[model samples]
Target: MVYDLNISAGELRASAGAADTLVTDLRPVLKKAVDDLTAASSSLRHWTAGPRMAETGEGWGGALGALRDNLTEHARGLRLLANGRDIMEQEVLSSFKGW
Candidate 1:
């Protein structure tokens, strides 16, 4: 394989930037999901749960759905980061002479 160090370096840098961007975007979403889950869990834990059962159930369901979606997004973001890291790593290894 023909390995051009200059192009590989640029690509690796770009991919690393993309990974950082993905992490930046994912963190807030994960945090919001955690916040929603915490709030829902707290409401359940502190319940006079019977009186507000229907309302609380509905709210909890919505929060859980939001959390689920956020988790999905996090998974996707993680995959992206993994792919970027893999590319960067391959570029690095390819640039080296003997490995």
Candidate 2:
């Protein structure tokens, strides 16, 4: 899963004084949030909304709960990513002086 985020690593690494700090600060939170979302999405896959859905009734409820948790975490993760992006945009991609 972490491998998939490689596309944005340049942006994430741009501001860090040391490469490890970037991983330290960002990886844990991002990992958990993504994992939660994945679990939620996976749970939802087994849900059947119509009658005779009993075959997966527990999964349906679990899916909803997982989705709820994922939604909440997703919002927070987005904010962190935005803040990190802003840091990269301002510190790494800019001269920190006006044009």
Top candidate, metric lDDT: 1
- What would the per-residue lDDT of candidate 2 be over residues 1-99, giving only the tens digit for each residue? 345554363453343324344445555665565555556656665554332343344455566556555555555565577577777877855775666
Candidate 2 TM-score versus the reference: 0.36
Task: Provide the TM-score for each candidate, comma-separated.
Answer: 0.42, 0.36
Q: Please tell me which predicted candidate would have the highest TM-score against the true structure.
A: 1
Alpha-carbon deviation at 91 in model 1, angstroms:
1.5
Model 2 residue 74 CA deviation in Å: 1.5
Residue 23: error of model 1 in Å? 20
Error of 1 at 93 (Å): 2.2
Displacement of the residue 17 alpha carbon in candidate 2, Å: 31
Question: Which residue runs does candidate 2 get wrong by more than 4 Å?
Answer: 1-57, 93-99
